[model samples]
Target chain A: MEEVHGRHSSGWFDVCQHRRMSNTRSLPLLAPESDAAAGPCCPPLTERPFTAEEAETAARMFKALGDPVRLRLFSAVASHEGGEACVCDISDVGVSQPTVSHHLKKLKEAGLLTSERRGTWVYYRVEPSVLSAMGKLLTVAPAVL
Target chain B: MEEVHGRHSSGWFDVCQHRRMSNTRSLPLLAPESDAAAGPCCPPLTERPFTAEEAETAARMFKALGDPVRLRLFSAVASHEGGEACVCDISDVGVSQPTVSHHLKKLKEAGLLTSERRGTWVYYRVEPSVLSAMGKLLTVAPAVL
Candidate 1:
């Protein structure tokens, strides 16, 4: 789980690649039927049942946000100046420096946030594609709800 | 945590009330300077940092979604016919009956889903407001990314 810039970091990259391929392949398989059926056949929780793989993949991201500290940290970074913040900006979360970094590392591995080293400190920003994908998975249209 | 019809069933209700009250109370507190400042001041996580209470409340929903089995079960219900599914419909998830039920109960208690008894079967449906709130929390505008 402590995969900062390690194999865990590349796991989401693989998921990203798989998702891209799934999108490209599923689009052409849709038949000209009802609008829902006519659209691409990609699997999302709200649109269709989750495959086992999809469940595990999406669960990782949700697990990363499950902790209060991590959720707060993510919010701090997301609403920070220019949508990015360094460790110093988030020091107000009241956790230790190493704890904050540890949580940040989890967010990165789960593909919710990305970090970049800048001289003496590392800055973090929300990963919009991952967030958007998760949001869309859980989002049912208001009318349908 | 087994609060299907217990007092714990009302926990998320309290959280929801706190969130609504927070939203109403925070807006007027914002200084009339910048547009962001003038808008709602509640900690939706995207617009502003989360207070400790908001983090605790929102984290409960995400924690309920952290497990892979629970995540899949939720998807099964969300994607099922009429946006509702019974235990029988989700039995294909490769988990034992009790395990699936346990996860389903957690989802229900977290306010992500609602359950109703129909004869011998219990049906579950996603709670759109809670899902929408969580989705909006993580959803950043495309331009921001």
Candidate 2:
């Protein structure tokens, strides 16, 4: 993504929201406890089993990212120029245009990306909030004491 | 994973490391030329289209967590008491014994978990290093704007 003014140029407003770097230590609120039980709310994964509900939610997200094709397509869009890139650029990658388009659609459905049409071309970029949420789910409070 | 120090337990360490929850940031080391010469020496999904070698390495990892059975299994183990749980306990979670065993084996191969036998039963827990590394790949930087 293009770096202008020391930040991504796509839409700087997202800059004011959740962010991280190798700062794996920080995470937002916990995932809601499994809906199957009225048990106490979330405890870190280290603390106890993630409830069934939490597992299902997390599983869905991971499933979306589980594909090799989709993961790379996500990277290409998230790191492309101007903080976004059009379908024309993404199609230049080795994957077939149809495959690339399919992957992009998945990324969009998963809320990891958003797009806009610039004339005949469609541009895509990371949905920072969604990205941050995924990052948060991966957050397993730092190594235990 | 053995409990360490008495109070906090080594299981916590296992959960973080084995689960691959550690985060890493991809600080663009080499510019992507805006052309075809993408570098290979970067984090999992940056700089270039994933090579066969790279895709295999990455696919292997994603494939490890690709299954619903394994995802639930990993969470089950990561949150198990004493920081680990026996495969038998895992097998009892509504699925057949063989399916649980298979998922556990895949998780072990992917480095997301580790197993050890306690008498006749084998217990598995998250691998702290792997978890941490996985966590890093999803890390995002604070916008510099």
lDDT of 1 at B76: 77
Please write out the lDDT profile of model 2 over residues A45-137, one tens digit for every residue.
Answer: 454556566665555556666777777676666655444666655564467889889888877765567677744556676665555555555
DockQ of all predictions against the true structure, Cα-based:
0.35, 0.19
Indicate which candidate wins on TM-score. 1
| Candidate lDDT (C-alpha), each | 0.65, 0.56
Interface RMSD of 2: 5.1
Q: Model 2, residue A10: what's the lDDT? A: 62
Every prediction's TM-score for the first chain?
0.66, 0.62
Residue-level lDDT of model 1, residues B86-142, one tens digit each, is: 676575577776888889989888877778786655667776556656766766655
For candidate 2, the TM-score is 0.64
Model 1 chain A scores worst on lDDT over the 10 consecutive residues at A21-30
Residue A60 displacement (Å), model 2: 2.1
Clashes of 2: 23
Residue-pair clashes per prediction, in order, are: 0, 23
- Each model's fraction of native contacts: 0.76, 0.32
